[model samples]
Target: MSDARLANARWPDVKAALESGKPIVAILPCGATEAHGPHLPLGTDVIISESIAAFALPKLEERGIHVLVLPSLAYAPAEYAAGFAGTISISMDAALALVLDIARSLKKQGFAMLALVNSHFDPANVAVLRDASETIVREIGLKVAFPDFTRRKLAEKLTDEFKSGACHAGQFEGSLVLASRPELVDDDARLQLPPNSNSLVAAFAKGAKTFEEAGGPQAYFGTPAGASAEEGVASLDCMSDMIVQAIAAQLEP
Candidate 1:
């Protein structure tokens, strides 16, 4: 197995690893503490992000990439989900600022690359991360990348059992949580919320209503009835593969 210490490693050890010329890649898992129906845990974003990093790190290390998985950023810009219970969201500005600072710190630390594994679907925050990445690359000269897992192609690769647009606390997120943390999922508590039939892409393109207005009353937009651990595992695997490919493409040579 690869030797990538996550929570256990201290700064001195990390610095020593860097000094030894070990190929190191820092993985920052970003998530939100929000309501995910009744079944999934409030920290769904945290679970997915950390799971992806944990599962992918060893694989990357096998390819000569030393990994350092950071703790998940549990507070995301989730104003839409804030209407629901257990949704603890941060402002877009604050989320962006925090991520930017983290990116800058990673750059200053002399890490070879930084990968942000984000699980939530906050478009505003995504834009913030994208802009921050650009700024870091341009100013601090850091090599960073955030893969877009929400793409239809990646989602399809993750699950064939669910229909498209079944995101949020629906089959996609529900199933993922089941796969990663089954104990946290309570099937009886699951609820099927109305789907956002409008085209998300179009909405984004047109700069339509904010996420809060778009998600509607329940603060969710998908069918949660079909969620299963098996499906979740498939989705996680697909996401891991995508992340691996992204890291291979973006990290410095």
Candidate 2:
């Protein structure tokens, strides 16, 4: 295929690639349509996840791997921000089923691998992905690659604000959106959002059910004013490296 993105490629090109017998890896960028504070757009997670996949295209190509970035999955279990406007939270069961079905279709299409690049950190969403990854490999016989940044090893590679757990709509995510879509960011509001140090991770651990219960009444955390496109670019590079490494490991015999 001339383009690495399935969204832009024709069906005939994909059929040709599959018939060539070279290992074809499909990347599914997973995100949530959730609130990201008043300063950022509702599609912040979608933008970040898709950007990571886009960045990974060249790296995967350089390694002689045939890769296609699938259209981004923009809805997930985002109940934590259900109170916010424009946040579409689906059930965990529904999310899991959708991912499983996607994997099954890819397996039947003769694709060698499916790499899921998820940027949304909702606990339920993460659970669905973890389960789907294992199920896809065990049942569908598909090689699955999922770089879950929520885990400590990957989480540490991100920004300090992200590690601090006050990162929902804060500097960490805000920076990513700013890097990819600056026009979507409300600079004036971002500059005025005071830092919210409450830890979403800790709050969730204690049974907090929503953003308000997690001390994020405005549906944001961390220091948004500290965000910058430069930092965002660096973060994207780091995340893309993680995806590349994960796929490389999965491709090993």
User: TM-scores, in order shown?
Assistant: 0.86, 0.99
Give residue 27's lDDT in candidate 2 (0 to 100). 96
Which tens-of-lDDT digit does each residue in 152-186 have in candidate 2?
99999999999999888899998899899999999
| lDDT score for candidate 1 against the true structure | 0.72
Task: Tell me the spans in candidate 1 whose CA falls farther than 4 Å from its real position.
Answer: 1-6, 152-156, 160-163, 191-216
* CA deviation > 4 Å runs, candidate 2: none
lDDT tens per residue, model 1, 56-87: 86678677767788767888787656677788
User: What is the lDDT of every predicted structure here?
Assistant: 0.72, 0.94
